[model samples]
Target: MGELVDFFVRSRNFILFVLLEVLCFYFIINTSNYWGATYFNTSNRYAAQVLAWSNAANQYANLRQVNADLALENQRLNARLTQLLQSKPAAPAEYQADSAFADRFKFVVAKVVNNTTQFANNYITIDKGTDDGIRPGMGVISPTGVVGKVKICNRRFSVITSILHSEYLVSSQLVKAREIGTAKWDGVDPHLIKLNDISLTKPVSKGDSVVTSDRNSTFPPGILVGRVRTIGVQPNRVFHDLTLDLATNFSSLSFVYVVENRLQAEQDQLEKQVETEK
Candidate 1:
C-alpha cells in the first residue's frame, strides 16, 4: 500500500497534465463550431459504417429465403413459358387461350439434395416428393435445360433418373436442322451425350441447338437438351454419329423444377385403352 501511494504521488503531475489536455480538447471541440462539426462528422461516419456492417449481416442471414423465393418465381415463369411454347405461332391471335385457361403444366421448385455424374447410372435426389405432387415419370429441369426424370417418390422426397444415367433417354430435335432423334448418355463423358437416329442427310452441324421433341410426353416440348458438339460418319450406318454437349451441368446442380403435365393422366389412359383394343 505504501509503494502504491508513492508511485501515484510521483505520477500525479503527469496524470493531471494528461487529464487537463483531454479536458482542454473536449472544451475546444464543444466551444468551437468548426471543431464540433468535425467531431460529429467523424462520429457519424463511424456510426454509418457500423450500420452498414449490421445490414450486410442481416442480408447474408436472409439469403436462403431469397433463394427459395427466386426458385418459386422461376417455376411460375417456366410454367407460363411452356404455355407460350405450346401455342401455334401461325395461328391467329384469337386462337390464343387465356393465360389461366391455357395453363397445361405446373412446376414445383425443388432443391437438389444429392446428385451424381461420375457413374454409368447416376441419379439425383431432390427435396420434394409425392406430397409436393412429384411422381414417377415426372420430368425435372434446371434453369438452363432438361435435368432428369423422376424415378421414385416418397411422401417427403424423391429420386430422379439423371439424364446422365445409362438407361436414360430423351426424345430430342435439332432446332436448325429440324431433325428428330434420341439423346442418350454414352456413360463415358459427363459433359457429352449421343444424338441417335438423326439421319446423315440432315443438315446438323456443330453448335446447333438440341431441344426436347414434341413426341416426348414426360417433358414439355422445346426445352433445351444440348448443343451439337461433334459429328461423325460411319460406314454402313445410315444415321450420322452425333455428340451433344449436355445443357445441364449435373455436377453443380443446386435447384430444379419438377414438371406436372395436367393432361398426363388423361393421355395415358386413352393410350392404354387404344393398346387394349388393338
Candidate 2:
C-alpha cells in the first residue's frame, strides 16, 4: 500500500495532465456543435467496425456446423435427382414399376472419418454403417463428384474402396461422344484415372467431360467423374489411352453421401441366377 502511494506520488503530474486533457476534450465536444458531431461520427465508425469484427468471429466459430448442415441438405437434393434420373415416363402397363423406382433411392450424409490417397489401394472410412442403411456395394459421392464404393460396414461405420484403388472400377462415359468405358486407377496419379475401351477411331479429345455411365449399378447415371486431360494411342493396346482429371480431390474429402439402391439385391440375385445357369 505504501509502495503504491509512493508510485502515485511520483507520477501525479503526468496523471493530472491526462485528466486535464480528457476534461478539455469533453468540454470542447460538448460546447462546440462541430466538435460533438465529428466526435460522435468517428466513435460510431469505430463501434461499427468492432461489431463487424465480432460478428465475423462468431461466424467463423460456427463454420463446421454450417458445413454439416449444408451437406445434409445436399444429400436430400442429390437423392431426389438420382430418383428422377432413374425414373422415366413409362407406358400405362409399366407405370407402377416406374413409380416404385421414383423413390427407390435414399442418400445418407456421412462424415469422412478416415481417408488415404498415397497408397496403391486407397480407402475411405465414414461415420455410418449398416445401422444407417449403409451396405457393402453402396455408392459414395462427394458434393462435387464420384468418390467410391462401400466395401465393408458395421453398425456405425463403413469403409469405402476409393476411386483411386488399383482394382476398383467405375463405369464412365464421355459426355460428348457418348462412349462408355471402364475407369480405373493405374496406381500412378491420384488426379488422373484411365478410361479403357474407347476406340481410337472415335472422336476423343482433350477437355471432354467424363461421367458415370447409365449401365452402372453403383452410382446413378450422369454423375461427373472427371474431364479428359489427354487422349493418345498405346503401342499395342486395342483401346485409346485416355487420362481424366478426377472431379473429387480425395485428399481434401470431408463428407460423403452413401447411396442406397432399394432394388439392387433383386437385380444382383437375378444376374447371379443367369450366370449360374450359363
Candidate 3:
C-alpha cells in the first residue's frame, strides 16, 4: 500500500497530463463535426477489422467439426445411393416380389491422417481401424476416385497401400472400348500410371476414360481410374503401352472412404475351393 502510494505520487503529473489530454481530445472531437466524423469512422473501421479477425479465427477452429459433419453426410448419401441401385427391378414379374439384389457394400468415412506420394511404395494412414470396421483387403476411395486398399489395421488406425505404389495393381477397363486391363504405377511419376494388358486391337486413344473393371471383387465396378494420356505400340507387340493421368491426386488427399464388401468372405471361400480343386 505504501509503495503504491509513493509510486502514484511520483507519477501524478504524468497521469494528470494523460487524463487532461484525453478529456481535451474528447471534447474537441464532440464539438467539431469533422473531427467527430473522423473519430467515429476510424473507430468503426478498427472495430470491423477486429471483428473480422475474430470471426476468421472462430471459423478456423470449427473446420475439423465441419469436415466431420460432411463426412457423415457423405456416408449417408452413399448408403442411400447403394440401396437405390440395388433396388432396381430385375424382371417385370419380379418387380413386385422381393428384390434379389441386396446392398453388398458398406462405406465408412475416414480422414487421411498421413500420406506419401514420393516413394516407390507409398502408403496412407486413416483415422479408422478394426474398431471402426476397417480391415485388410478393403478398398479405399476418395470423393473423386479410388485411393487405395487397406493393408493393416488395429484399434484406431489403418494403413493403406496407395495406388501410387509400384506393386499396386487395379483391375481396370477402358470406358469407350470396353477393353479390360491392369492399372499399375510405373514408379516414375506420381501423377501418372500405366494400364497394361490392353490389346492393340482395342480402340484405345488419348483422352479415353478408364475405370474399375466389373471383375474386381474389392472395388465397385465403374469407379474412375484415370484418363488415357498416351498410347504407344511396339513392333510385333500384342498390347499397347498406355499412360494415364490418375483421377485422385494422392498429394492432396484428405478424406477417403473404406469400402466393405459384405459378401467378400463368401466370395473368397468359393474362389479358394475352386483353386484347391484345380
Candidate 4:
C-alpha cells in the first residue's frame, strides 16, 4: 500500500493532466452543440461498424445450421412438387406409356447419419429404419436428384448404397432422345456417372437430361438422375458411353427421401409367376 501511494504520488502530475484533458473535452462537448454533435456522430459510426462486424461473425458461425435448414426446406418443396405432378391425369388413353410406371412411392425424410465416399463400395446411413417403414431395396433420392438404394434397415437406422459406390446401378433414360440405359458410377469422379447401353442411334448431346426409367422395379420412372455432360462412342462397342453430371451433390447432402414402392411385393410376385411359366 505504501509503495502504491508512493507510485501514485510520483505520477500524480501525469494522472492530473489526463483527468484535466478528459474534463476539458467533456466540457467542450457539453457546452458546444456542434462539438457534441460531431462527437456523437463519430461514436455512432464506430458503434454501427462494430455491430455490423459482430453480426457478420455471428452469421458465419451459424452457417452450417442455416445450410441444413435450407436443405430440409428444399426437400419439402420437392416432395410437394412430386405430389402435384403425379396427381395429374394423362392427356390420352392411347399414350401407351412404357416409361410411366405405377408405384406407391412414399417419401420418408431423414437426415444422413453417416456417409462415405472414399471407399470402393461407398454407403450412407440415415436416421431412419424398418421401424419408420424403411426397408431394403427402397429407392432413395434427394431434393436435387437420385441418391441411391436402401440396402439394409434396422429399427431406427438404414444404410444406403450411394451412387458413388461401384455396385450402385439405376435404370436411367435420356430425357432428350428417350434412350434408356443403365446408370453406374465409374468410381472416379464423385459428380460423374456412366450411362451405358444407350444406343448410338439416339441423338445425345451435352447437357441432355437423364431420368430414372420405369423398367426397374426399384425406383419409379421420371425421377431425375442427372444430365448427360459427355457422350463417347467406343470402338467395337455397340452402344454409346455417356457421362452424366449427377444432379445431387452428395458432399452437401443432409436430408434424403426414402421412396417406398407399395406395389413392390405385388410386382415381384407377378414377375415370379412369369418366371415360373418360363
Candidate 5:
C-alpha cells in the first residue's frame, strides 16, 4: 500500500493533465454542434466497423446451423416442386379404375441418398422403399429430364438404374418427326445418351429434341429425354446412331419423383403373353 501511494504521488501531475485535456475536449464538442456532429460521425463509423466484425464472427460460429437450415428449406422446396410436376389430369366422372398403377401414378418424393456417375453401370439409391409404393420398373425423373427406372426396392429404400448406366434403355421418340426408337446411354459422357433404331433415312439432325414414346413398356409418352447433338450414319447401317445431350443434369440431382404405375403388373403380364406367343 505504501509503494502504490508513492507511485501515484509521483504520477499525479501527469494524470491530472490528461484528465483536464479530456474534460476540455468533451466540453468543446458538447458546446459546438459542428464538433458534436463530427464526433458522432467518427464514433458511428467505428461502431459500424465493430458491429461488422462481430457479425462476421457470429456467422462463422453458426455456419453449420445455417447450412442445415438451408438444406431443409431446399428439401421442402423440392417436395413442392415434385408435387407440382406430378399433378395429373382429373379422370372423368364416368371413368372408374380399380388398378393401382392406372389410377395412381403417384409421385413419391425421395431424396437421392447415394449416387454414382463414374461407372459404366452406375446406380443411385433413394430414401423411399416398397412401403412408399416404389416398385421395380417405376420411372424416376427430375424436373429437367427422365432419370431412370427403378431396379430394386427394399422395405425402406430403393435403387434406381440411372440413365447414365450402360444397361439403361428407354423407348424414346424424336419429337419433331415422331420417329420412335430405344434410347440408351453409351457409358461415355454423363451428359449424353444414344438413340438406337432410328433409321438412317429418318432425317434426324443435330439439336433435335427427343422424348419418351409410350409405345415402349416403361415410360409414358412425351417425357423430356434429351436433344440430339450429333448423328452418325455409317455406311450400310440400318439405323442412325444419335448422340444426345441429356436433359437432366445428373451430377446435380438431389430430389426426384418416383412414378407408381397402378397397372404395371397387369401390363407386364399381358406383354409377357404376347412375347411368349411370338
Candidate 6:
C-alpha cells in the first residue's frame, strides 16, 4: 500500500495531464456537431468490428458440436433414403400388397480416429464399436459416397477395410448400362479404382456413374462408388478394362456412417440353408 501510494504520487502530474486531455476531447466532441458525428461514427465502426470478431470466435468454438449434429442428421436422412429406395416398386403388378417398407438399415455416426490411404492395403479406425452398434461386416459410408466395410470391432473402437485396399472388393454396376462389375483398388492410386467383369459390349462410357449393386448384402443398392474415368479393352479379353475416380476422398475423411442391415442375419441363414441342401 505504501509503495502504491508513492508510485501514484510520483505519476500524479502525468495522470492529471491525461485526465485533462480526455476532458478536452470529450468537450470538443460534444460541443461541435462535426466532431461529435465523426467520433460516434468511428466508435460505431470499432464496436462493429469487435462484435464481428467476437461472433467469429464463438462460431469457431461451436464447430465440433455443429459437425456432430450434422452427422446425426445425415444418419437419419441416409436411413430414410435407403428405406424409401428399397420400397420402390419395379412395376405395378410386381408390387406386393403385403410388402411394407421397413427400416432394415440402421446408421451409426462415427468420427474417424485414424485413416490411411498411401499403403497397398489401407484401413480406417473409427471412434465407435460394439457399444455403439458397430460390428464387423457393417458397411461404412461417408456423406459423399461409399467408404469401406468394418473389419474388426471392440467395445469402443472399430477398424474398417477401406475401399482403397487391394483386398477390398465391392459389387458395383453402371447406372446407365446396368452392367454388373466388381470394384477393386489397383494398389497403386488412392483416387482411382478398377471395376472388373464389365463386358466391353456393355453400354458404358466415360463419365458414366458407378454405384453399389443390390446383390451385395454388405452395402445398400445405388450408393455411389465413382464416375467412370477411362475405359479400355485388353486384346482377346471378354471384359473391358475400366478405371474410376472414387467418390470419397479418403485423405480428408473425418466422419462416416456405419450401416447395419437388420435382416442380414436372416438372409445369410436362409442362403446357408440352400447351400447345405445343394
Best-fitting candidate, scored by lDDT: 6
Q: Candidate 4's residue-wise lDDT over 31-118, tens digit each?
A: 9999999999999999999999999999999987987788667656665665555555244755442323321556778889889877
As a whole number from 0 to 100, the lDDT of residue 206 in candidate 5 is 87
The digit string of per-residue lDDT tens for model 6 on 93-116 reads: 666522333567788999999999
Candidate 1: deviation at residue 37, Å? Answer: 6.2
Tens digits of per-residue lDDT for model 3, 118-211: 8999999999999988899999988778898999999999999999998899999999998899999999999999999999788887999998
Q: Estimated TM-score per prediction? A: 0.81, 0.92, 0.82, 0.83, 0.67, 0.93
Which candidate order results from sorting by TM-score in descending order?
6, 2, 4, 3, 1, 5
- Candidate 1 C-alpha lDDT tens digits along 145-261: 999899999999999999998988899999988889999999999999999999988888899999998786788888999999999975798998999999988887888999988
Q: Over the full model, what C-alpha lDDT does candidate 1 score relative to the true structure?
A: 0.90
**What residue runs in model 6 are displaced by over 4 Å at the alpha carbon?**
1-6, 89-93, 97-102
Instruction: Give the poorly placed runs of model 1, Cα more than 4 Å off.
Output: 1-50, 89-102
* Comparison by lDDT, 2 against 4, better one: 2
Cα displacement (angstroms), candidate 2, residue 207, comes to 1.8
Location of the lowest summed lDDT over 10 successive residues in candidate 4: 94-103
Q: For residues 125-205, write the lDDT of model 2, one tens digit per residue.
A: 999999888889999989999999999999999999999999999999999998899999999989989999998777988
* CA lDDT of each prediction against the hidden true structure: 0.90, 0.90, 0.88, 0.84, 0.80, 0.91
Model 1 poorest ten-residue lDDT run: 96-105
Give the clashing residue pairs of candidate 5, or none. 100-262, 101-261, 101-262, 101-263, 102-262, 102-263
The Cα RMSD in angstroms, rounded to one decimal, for candidate 1 relative to the true structure is 4.1
